[model samples]
Target: MTPSLPDILVGNFLCMAEPPPPESAGEFMAGKVGVVALLSLLAAQEAERGPSARVWENAAIRAVLTDAAEAYGDAFAEAGAGVDTDFTLGALDRANAALRRSLIALHEAVETAGDVVRDHAILRLYGQMADARRLDMPPLPGR
Candidate 1:
């Protein structure tokens, strides 16, 4: 006999545990359904896009940093220094945030000067910072 929703509810309410082994008819239909399949598909999609999205974001940041470094000369040397490190999704994320904040200053400085070369370069950096911020991972809560 197929289990009913009430039977399943009695067995595993609030994700307490697996539904009881309902030997009777009404209990059989009450167990969880294709949750595994849905979860599997979602996991696969996240795995595929996760790395490439981060890499692409890093590439965009790199392009902006490289340009700004050239334009600013030696001022941003340290900014470009550790940026090339092999960062996990987490570390790269933190750095991405800092870069975004830095882009604000870069924009202000370049905007006041109106130098075509620096102006255009800073524009690229601004766009990149915006893109990076959008792609940035969410912060983890303190344990």
Candidate 2:
């Protein structure tokens, strides 16, 4: 059976990290290896979880926009109505990017209007976005 993308990334990370690189390669090379290994690990996580996380974040942001539309404007309602049937990472990311721009505008509008309730909702959504995108970073070696 063919190995998954995450599995391949893990394999690459192992190959780079094992034997700890040559001592002759010095600190710079070791540092480079560490960086590449970290990237590989992060990429693996994204490969497995990125799409779902983005979808959830997008939906949550849209919900906030929809609810705020009455106080803000119909533009927010229209923005919230957007759908990403493509579901490809790139497509979803594009839709997400646009929605994020709208979200930012809505945030500014709420703050400017002193709409505490909407502002709090937007702030909560921001926290959720950060949590959704958080990486499962492995602890440094030797504690």
Top lDDT model? 2
Cα misplacement distance, residue 77 of candidate 2 (Å): 1.0
The TM-score values for the models, in the order shown, are 0.45, 0.79
Instruction: Give one digit per residue, the lDDT tens place, for model 2 in 1-143.
Output: 63445566777767676675466388877776787778778777887788998899888888888998898899999999966688787777878888999999999998899989888888888898988877798998867
Q: Residue 136 of model 1: what lDDT? A: 29
Q: After superposition, how far is residue 73 of candidate 1 from its true place, in Å?
A: 4.7
| lDDT by residue for model 1 (1-143), tens | 63322343444343445454547336344333333333344445444554555566656555555567766655454454454366465665566657656656666666776767767866765575455434223343342
- In model 1, which runs have C-alpha deviations exceeding 4 angstroms? 1-47, 83-87, 121-143
Q: What is the C-alpha RMSD of each candidate to the true structure, in Å?
A: 13.1, 6.2
TM-score of candidate 1 on Cα atoms, chains taken together: 0.45
What is the Å distance of residue 127 in model 2 from its true position? 0.3
Reference-based TM-score, model 2:
0.79
